[model samples]
Target: MSVTLARELACARSRLFGLRGVTIEQGRILLGALEACPRWRERPGIGELRIFRSAAGHEVLLVPSTGRVQIRVAYVVPPIERFDAAAGVLVELARLGRAARRAG
Candidate 1:
């Protein structure tokens, strides 16, 4: 993780602390999911906003967009299984990224 992102995530964790409907543990899991997936886009003019979309269509929508962090979860998938699958996808993507860099 980039220094800026790490800082942003820390701030996000602080912001999420004690908020209703999202437990501290859940917040950690959600942030972990965000870190696992590759970044989708950086919304210009937003400070340290991290948006990630997995290939399987799970999303970690973090900071400022909705004025809150949220996971737009695919309801058909259970939480544990969904994150497990996401980890697999991320590993493949990382391998591909490394291969492409070497090839180039």
Candidate 2:
């Protein structure tokens, strides 16, 4: 399941965000962040996903759940293009996660 999820995430990053390549280390880091969330299993719908700019100018991916808040990704760059790309990847992740949860 992890293998398939990784592949899907990679494809989404490349195709949707126009990322040339997502290194294994980055993928692992992102997946690790997601796994660390206590409410990771309670997949939030894409509409519920929130993107916000941090005070340090990073793009943050926030997933709101019942009792806990899940922050999925944080892109360091502040450029609009980077933020758009990060948001796109995040939205795709939420969509995939939601579908997987429903299927299961």
- The model with the greatest TM-score is 1
- Worst lDDT run of 10 residues, candidate 2, spans 1-10
Please write out the lDDT profile of model 1 over residues 1-104, one tens digit for every residue. 10111112222221111112433444444445445435442233247556566555544454532334444434456644644544443444335434444544
TM-score, per-candidate, Cα-based: 0.34, 0.27
Cα lDDT tens digits, model 2, 2-101, are: 3221211332232223222334443434444455444334333467554433333333344333212222233444334544545554565455445555
Best by lDDT: 1
Q: What C-alpha lDDT, on a 0 to 100 scale, does residue 102 get in candidate 2?
A: 53
Backbone collision count in every prediction? 0, 0
Off by over 4 Å in 2: 1-79
Model 1: CA > 4 A from native: 1-45, 48-52, 60-75
